[model samples]
Target: MRGDRVTNEGTVPSDSRRFCLYFAHIELAQKVQAGREAKRTLHEAGVAIKKQIIANTKSNKSERHKHLDELEQDLKILENELKEKEELKRQAEIPENAAKERHQKLWKVEKRAMQDLISRNNQMREMFADLDTNGDSLISIDELQKHRELDTNPENEFTVEEVRSILGSDSIDLNKFNTTVFDQLSNSYGKLLEPTRPTPEPTPLAEPSIDSITTQPSSLEIPTDEEDLRTHTRSSYKNEDDSEDDYEEYNHRGSSSIATSLEHEKHIHDSIAPEYDDETKRLIQIADEARNRYHEVGEKLLSIKRQIDDSKKQSSVDTGLHDEYAAIIDQCFDYEEREYTYRICMFKTANQIPKGGGSEVTIGYWDSWCGPKDNKYLKMKYSNGATCWNGPPRSLIVTLQCGTEQKLTDVREPSRCEYAMIFETPLACDETIATTSAHLDHVEF
Candidate 1:
């Protein structure tokens, strides 16, 4: 059967085949035309339909005006909804930005607050460390009890309530309780319990002024009484009588010689007075005043020296107390500038002065150390030193140390109105034979 179909093509059904071909051609042609019409319609429309629909819905004069009005109402509703949605979106974005800003501000504030807290904690720790007498990490109740006992008056023992009140709440920060409070308590107790040093009243010096001296002429004027006059007359009469006897004995006394002698005596008196010029008189008055002042100063110095000598004697007798001070002075003091009489005591005092100036003209001392007795060993002498321009004065304390040579190591003006200097002197060096031996032992073999 397969071979017979391959040989005869007329065996195919013509009516069905013709009908299928005709339908297929017609469908193809219709499809091609529909595609062209769709393309043309899209090109020609150019969004006009959308515009027309919008216009029709919006227009009042049209057959479907009522329906267009209904659509317009719907569109208005949709637009209102869209606006609400956009506002909601904006509100949501606002919160996000606000939240970010708030977070940044909060972070900075929190960071600073934490740092402040840490600083306060460190300060509290330091306070605690200062208070911890035993260097232990914790303050014991026994120690606190002992302190309470010491603080409480013997007549009025501390009650539990009082102790609790002083300690504050049980939840109090133990770290905050330091020796400062105890120290303050101790100071208060000392003030109440211990005897205080009596303040010495300053000795009022008899400062007799120049005006006082002028007012009291009797204090100044030398006495020229009848006794003095009588004594002078007797001496002069006796000398004249002796001279007359000699003249009588030697009758040829030269007249020129006598005249010359009188002239020479007058010249000597004139030289002594020098016609009393204003400058010379003023200088004489000054010298007199200076002499008086010098006498007063000498008396004062004698008194001071006696007091110092007495004190030294007393100190030598008090071996226990005075020995320490003596040892300290021995260790610390230094001398320099033997030619200019400059002396410096390290950690104690320094003084300098010109040659032949004596203690009165000395430049004065500068004390660097503050001792237990609060005894000041120096004076500033602001008025006495060399003056400075637009400033008070240029003053210095030459600090001394152990050295082989007398030399100035450094000079500094720490403030606008102050100066300091470091000096070296052989006197400060360890000159003992033992010290030298020790130094030799330390040296390389």
Candidate 2:
């Protein structure tokens, strides 16, 4: 069977040649079948792999288009939001700019108004300064009536309390003269004018019945100056011999009718009222002043008598009354008048400091108790200070008075570089009647 051949010997029909036995070649047959099976498995696997690739590529393309569309929508939404915000800002700027302009205009108007007020106040200061003649910072209703610019009619007349309220002081307040007083005076009179005044006439005297003995005139805002009483008096026309004899007799009598020190001074305001401007008033004033002067001179004579008695006695430099007010020593007290701040240090120094920031000036230095002859402790003098511009050396006289509290008030420049003020304190309360009486109707420097 291994060598069997289909040749001409068999000569079988081509269709009958299948009977040739080849069973011995089974191994070759098996190898051929295995190759066919491997080819079939390889072709089937390739087809399946190609189909899967096409399907996956299509799905990926669709997903990419969806993602790109979503990204575009988000970008559009963000752009629209940005446009809305910009439009809102543009709308808001219209009112914001307008508000700024309005505020600027209002500020300008207010600034102009404030400047006008200051200018008006400055213009009024010169007019009011003339009202204070004695450097006492006071003005009487009778004095105010002299100016037609002031409405001094009875309906608008100023009482003492009314003046104190409107002026905010007992005197013509310089601080308020340019503010509240300016407004009030301007409202009362349409325009403010500087009063063209004549030389002042001497004030007349009056009787005591019109007002209380202890009280000053109801029309007066403050007490009339004692110096004014003596200096501004009208003399009673009489023979020179009679006047001299009267003075001599008063000196001999020695103020025996002087009831009390305060009462003696009060008689000028209480006893000699301005309504009693007759010969009787003149006689009363003359007698009162003579008694006061007699009291003063008698005390002086007695003081000299004591000094003569102690002529051989050793003179003492003991502090005495000076030490009583030693607590005020080295302590600074300030009194404001006009543009300067007056500073006084008891038994030390005095100064005038400018309010608008300038070099401080030395007013004076403590010198001595320069009061009247009888009571040497009533006034303190400071001298030999910084000189005026080509003038005398500056000096300050502090007049001491008895009061419940310690204070400095009424600073005045009576003469060139010569200053004066009143210092009230409790230390002077216990002085002798003789000392107090000497200063009753007068205080001499």
Candidate 3:
């Protein structure tokens, strides 16, 4: 104690620290037990006073009646005092119990965090082992950069120098500073990490009752565009008389009933043909010319359409590409699954046609091609077509692979109101790319 500035010099040693903590814990436990005992004493004292009062209530009244009131007052006072002590005990324990519960919850959280760290640590160890394949306990820069997937950002992929900087050397020791290695690996290659998804159990495919969309025999030929068809029809009927104008109007209304057209023709010949007096002969001649021209032009237009089809097909073959050539449109692919034949029309829609002669139902309409442009195979989506009984609007994903002919390989409804079809089509072929790539490879050293 120099100059009255007295200071304690003894410091606790490391080996005795545990004992000191244990002693403090014991003291806390003793204090808690003492508080509990005090509350119990107060409760017992109140119970004894209650029993004494009850015993005095039935005793000889002449001797103790004067003290009976005093005894009753004392009992009430004791009860009140006991209640106050109990309340005090509860108030004292509340913060302690709350703190205990909070500590328990925090411990659980920390435990889980530690477990996750252990898991991540083990994963890192395995990755390092794989990267250090040479058994030198060090991963070289070349080996590290070989996995370009390690670059989390594709736009700013790691250069060799960046990788070396991250490694802190030309090579990284697998056993040294594991946490640092884990962090660096995570920062660079975490996106390449594959996460597992929980797969659902397979469910049986459902079959729906068929509904009719059409009655005519299904034709495989591509339908002409409306603009082209309109042009052809206008040119073909330009020379027809006014009498034929009504028929053209009927046709333009999209009537497919041959019976109706025939009936109208009969009406013209029977009713209208007899109205003209002396001009009947000339009108008859004119009607005959118009009829002849109509049939001739119809035949010529059909022949010309067929020729155009043949030329487009030939051009597709010459170019050695099908779907990309613009000439292979409106093609149909039929896939039979269970009891239904799914007919998917390219650039149009898909139909669920029953095999046992039921109505054809529209399942989906062509939305667009669904993947990257340069991909050899095609993924097309048909959407907003049919309505399911208890589900959303039906949709189909049609996957097309190159083949010699058009046909379906597989059909499945993998989810409710959603269909998947794998089909083969000559239109999917890209022979030009395939052949040139192969030839170039042969010419290389």
Candidate 4:
């Protein structure tokens, strides 16, 4: 029975109990399945999330690398640009430096040329002054001939052949052959004439006087009858009172003789006074006139001497401008960052530059009044020039010439902050044109 009952309970189970057991079993199985499924799902989800995270990290790293590379390229490009700019700056400075050097060279050349012109002009002026005769402004053939004749020595008179040899073929003009032919021929040869010796002064004469050779005459004699007078006197004296009267008469006669001699000497002196007075007045007048003439002659000689001294002083003082060229440069132009000007006078004090601005350039003449005749070169003062940054004020130099007009020809900058200028003027023209022509002819001979 127990066996049968256990079999029945197991086979047919109690409805409620069976159901409860079955339900509990099913629920437990479901819960366990659900837990298992949930665990699997969670593990799958974690794996997926890890995969996504790794992919995202790789993408982000790649982008960062790309950006870094781009930044590096940009840095390289900026460095190359900076290098190019540095090279361009170096190239730009070269031309400016070269220009400054070129201008300095030009200034030196222009200065030398101006000096040469001045020297040539001075030489011509001297020749003209030497040839000008008779203190006249013009030089004619006749006047030149007189000079030639005066220059020739009596002992060495020029022969026709000698004259021809000295003058050459061009000495005469066939169309103008008159009495002037001889004169022209002589003039052509006059330059070759030598200086003559001067004449000596004459000696003075001795004077003679009439008073040194005259002799004086003797005094006249007078006689008296002393014996007769003595005999008569003795007879009268025989009477007692007669002897005393005779003695008194002899004393009276002696006194009368002395009085007559004194009266004669007084009359002679009174007669000569008028003639002596006239002679003295005449001698005084003549002496005064002679003294006045001597004073006039002395004054003339002194004036001549003074003139000669002045001429000598002028000649000595007038030296060539070349010697003082450096000093002249200092006087003319001042150095500045912008430019420089230079000026020089051949034989006078020169101003180098001027003060101020603009295109107008002014030139001056040599200080002629302060210098000698030989030093009379034209001087110029320039003004309104370039300005400097932090240096001296604008200035200029004085240039000398022998031309017809005073004008600036050109201005330029040849160096860094340096300048050069060219000028022309009438003051630079040759004043002795005729004399220069004559000199050239002489040189050809």
Candidate 5:
């Protein structure tokens, strides 16, 4: 090649320089080709592995589907049985409908009686307490007449003579309140008042009246406050000097008071003699028996129904969880805090960078989902990161809450080197977003 372009004692030529440039390009091309070949081999291996995984998943799903057919058949039988029972109960209910009216009336009457007595007793106790305010179980005639509330009405204001007759003196000792000496002194009441007819609970009354619901003694409206109507023991005291027999005798003295006491108890329980005819009673018994049977059948049907529902869920086609978590793959989120910049690389690593230009600290590495079993994907646990100065290795729990877009927020150390952060992500929403992969030709690797 040492022709006219070369010298006799040749050193270099312009054309020879082109040859150097050509070989340099060739060497660069060869290196690039070698790198592409290695990348291709690795890419092919990854594809093969992915196909095997897909095949295994399909095999597992097929095995699960085999039991699904039998489960569906069982579910159908249970559904039919449940429907039959429900129809039978509906038919039985039609016959029992007539008896229900009488039963409801009886229950209402009984409730009215109890509520009325309770109302009356509460009022009576309040009135007596107001009459004797000095903590002495004695009602003074002076206090009774001069009392501010008693001035409201004539009925509330009794004459001095009338008060003396009841007390046997100027003061009435409530300890001896049942003493019926006033009965001999005056003929104010010749006959017992008529038995009070039961009324609805909402009606306020001072005293039980024979006029039934038509009258409510306005002076002392019933304390309808539910707390005032509670049943309580009659609180009394017997000093050491008082003998047991004497105490018993004092409590037993007043005949009229005794009659009133017995009548009060009667009003509470045996107030209205429920008179159901023999036919009505027979109908009630039949209805009650039917109700019991209906309830038992209903409970059994519910149990079967729950099982069917659970079976249906188990039998449904398995939509592999692989897609459920695909949205989080390779996603990274950052949160700016007062003292640190927190970062979370989903299924990778979590780290916190100091705001004051210090080295970034490794918080943790993604381990597994640590949420409750019912919703396993709600939380992501990361563990075994850089060890703390005087504590165990670092760990983190990323709590996922449903959001329109992904975010890392509220980064904090719940305990020393035990980090926690809230992650708002659309992947946490109820519905999973499915994704598709597209193949591209002429890939470098």
Candidate 6:
């Protein structure tokens, strides 16, 4: 055995030798193709966003705004879809399964981007339909010039030469006609698209024809008395059933107040009956003066009714406050300052009466209700007052403080032409002192 071992070299059996190694089995060719396809899709979408269908380089603000808004919406949708597909792929454990699903998802996104391009082009087609007046699928320079003429301003004039230069042709096909040129035109002369109506035929002149003069109707009769005609000429607004008392009231008031009314009547009478004799005109004037007197009496009666209604409202006990302050609701709180006598009639308009003798001016009207229900006692806002000279409209805000007597303690102009007043009133307290003290005692126990 020693002689045989010396002559033969020992060799390890191939199957008995053990080896362990790790490597990724990635399909490089498939990955490279998928990456190229994704890059191509992204490039196509970029080109679509910058697609231009118009001849002119100028862009309208409105159209640009619309395109940008739509592009943003599309991009948002694309991002959401990509996130959803990525989540789905991550959930799949097998690499082959994930790659196949990702490829399908990416194809869908590419299709969507292509649709956006088609939709944008379709918008241009619809606009071309509006501009194609002859329906020959073309827009001529002459047609554009005619539309330009509709603009009244001389500076707005558009020439055939300008149109040809912009369009680069005498007639633009449907595709080119609906480009940026149409957008600029629509912005400048959109109103010209409205169809104009045909001019109406004029009526024949009312000449004294021989047939009309010969065939004068027998029933035609003109009134002789101008005074009777004038009385019938009274406005249809006059009442037919006016009471005798109203007529008596009209006679009691002197004619001096109606002198202006009489002058207006005379002017109207002269214009209506210029061909009438002086006596006729005078009679018409007298009748008009009597009608005016009746109108003046009616106006006075209306004024009396308004005053009575106002008095009733002031005396009513419907003030929305505590019983103690109910009397103050309708009563006026007069605050006399250096230059003006201010009156704040509760739940009514505030007024500023000049002390030295100027017109009474309205400060503002009460706009909000102030009380416990609103969790406020003294905050009152008055707005829409009479306009100030060289300033904004006057407004006032009143803040009420607790006091025994109702008075306006201080006034200040905190802003330009705006007055803020601190008013003191007994009604400003929500809870009595005795009640608050009792509540505090209970809490301490």
Leading candidate by TM-score: 5
Per-residue error (Å), model 1, residue 46: 99
Candidate 4: clashing residue pairs, number: 33
For candidate 5, lDDT tens digit of each residue in 379-430?
8899998999988999999898655456875788879989999987545554
Candidate structures ordered by TM-score, highest first: 5, 6, 3, 2, 1, 4
Model 2: per-residue Cα lDDT at residue 175: 44
Question: Which of the predicted structures, 1 or 2, would earn the higher lDDT when compared with the native?
Answer: 2
Q: Give the Å shift of residue 342 in candidate 1.
A: 9.1
Cα shift from native, residue 425, model 2 (Å):
0.8
Instruction: Tell me the tens digit of each residue's lDDT in model 1 across 1-445.
Output: 2322332546543566656667777676667667655544443342343234335433522433454455455555655555555555555455444333333332332233333333333344443343344655444444344454444665776555554555553322333242223333434332233222332112221222222212212211211444543343334234323544433322232210111111122223233311332333444555555555545545554554555554444334321121212222312333334444444333233444456666522232432332234322211121234445686654554444434344566545586545555655333332232122111111111
By lDDT, the candidates rank as 5, 3, 2, 6, 1, 4
For candidate 6, report its TM-score: 0.29
List the global CA lDDT of all models. Answer: 0.38, 0.51, 0.52, 0.37, 0.54, 0.49
TM-scores for all predictions: 0.19, 0.26, 0.28, 0.16, 0.32, 0.29
In the order shown, the candidates' Cα RMSDs to the true structure are 56.4, 54.2, 56.8, 52.4, 18.8, 46.3
Q: Which runs in model 5 stand beyond 4 Å of their true positions?
A: 1-15, 80-172, 179-445
Worst 10 residues of 6 by lDDT: 436-445
Please tell me which model should have the higher lDDT, number 5 or number 6.
Answer: 5
Taking all chains together, the TM-score of candidate 1 against the true structure is 0.19
Query: Of models 3 and 6, which has the larger TM-score?
Result: 6
Clashing residue pairs, backbone N/CA/C < 3 A, model 3: 212-359
lDDT of 3 by residue, 358-396 (tens): 788788986766746776246778899789998898999
Candidate 2 TM-score versus the reference: 0.26
Tens-place lDDT per residue, model 6, 292-388, is 5545554554554555455445445333333333445656888888998888877677888999998988888877644345645557777788899
Q: List runs of model 3 lying over 4 Å from the truth.
A: 1-282, 291-328, 372-377, 401-406, 425-445
TM-score of 3: 0.28
Assess candidate 3 and give its lDDT.
Answer: 0.52
Model 4: CA > 4 A from native: 1-277, 319-402, 405-445
Clashing pairs in 2: 205-273, 206-272, 206-273, 206-274, 207-273
